[model samples]
Target: MTGTIHNRETFLSQIASSLGRSRLSSGVTDPEWKHRPQDQVLQDATPDELVDILKTQCLKIHTSLVITDAKKLPETLHEVVANYGGGPIVTWKDERFSKWGLEPLMKKEWPSQKLEVYEWDHTKGAENIRQAEKANVGITISEMTLAESGTVVLFSDKDKGRTVSFLPATYIALVPKSTIVPRITQAARKLRELHHSGKQVASCVNFITGPSNSADIELNLVVGVHGPVKATYIVIDDL
Candidate 1:
């Protein structure tokens, strides 16, 4: 047991060091990969044009879902769901949806709406994705969201599996305002870091901006032809 422990620690340290060095060489070491400024920390939606964008996008999508930090579950999630037709709220084990005083609130807003609150364990990524796909909507917390391209980044590990975010019909991602970066290149650097750290690479890493759409044939646009038909994102001000 002692030898095994020593070997594992040694391996992890070596991997972390190599990953750090490689990322630095790849020009990923820069904190700001893009010149665009980080998105503003939005507290109230009324003033920000994002409100109109959110409303329009939500109405256009088939399913609207929101994934917020367990510590910062937005007060508006239930309201939005109720207005757009209620759907399930899939979360991770640490999300603490029940403890955050959300269950009762949702119950009140959507007395007749069915709420499927699932706790994700990373080992069950395959199962979780299957369940998320069956539902019309799915929401999961994100590591970070890029504002310029409207892309969301997800990392896989023991707690955050990949399926919950990628397989649903409409994916609602909750990202902290602080976690909002300017570009996908910054996100790719983070992924490279994770890869070098010897963490198990996710079977899937999705960077979703809008609804799953395709203009593959005749330049005619189509939605839900491949992935989720819709995606709604809420960048909570607080982490």
Candidate 2:
């Protein structure tokens, strides 16, 4: 981000000089932006209200939202898997899945299980991408969520690869209620604190609002052009 600012300064300086305007210098710091009505609404929302607002915003962008108990996550995941039918499942290595007791649903089941799922190996580099490309579902746990825009924030790591949230037909985000901030600013503040505290922040932090869609071709809306055809956000009430 700092590098981006430096590049922007150079580019803007050239444009400003051409227009005979004052250059946006590197020393210039923009004033902090005030909150908009949408932002303020989220900032003052209760937990339930935040979820409702997030769900509404998510639906507007063609993302499905589901609320479920932490303990019932296995059942919810089963339904998601059933909806997608049996296929290769690629998931990020989040400890929350284990804490939520979704092992039975994620891993190979016993002899009498209803459905069998192929768990993609959590590897690195091209191998992981190769596995995820053929996967039907990409499951990940959000580090935090933005209620104002219904965005799920994912950080890439050794356990959670970047492609784990992309390159799949279906993307499912498992977010805990506690991790859902009232707005994006709050989320950014938390991450900034973590960074300043000397905690190891991941190299990539992806803020996903919805499935990849575009209407640039001919004005007709298109879905899943560069991302999942279906995106689902499963919010856990208790985590």
lDDT of each residue in 157-237, candidate 1, tens digit only: 666656666576666676666666545656776778879998766756766666677779999878878766666676565
TM-score, prediction 1: 0.58
Highest lDDT scorer: 2
lDDT of each: 0.59, 0.80
**Which residues of candidate 2, in runs, are more than 4 Å off?**
1-41, 110-124
Q: What range of 10 consecutive residues in model 1 has the weakest lDDT sum?
A: 39-48
Quote each prediction's TM-score.
0.58, 0.80
- What global local distance difference test value does model 1 have? 0.59
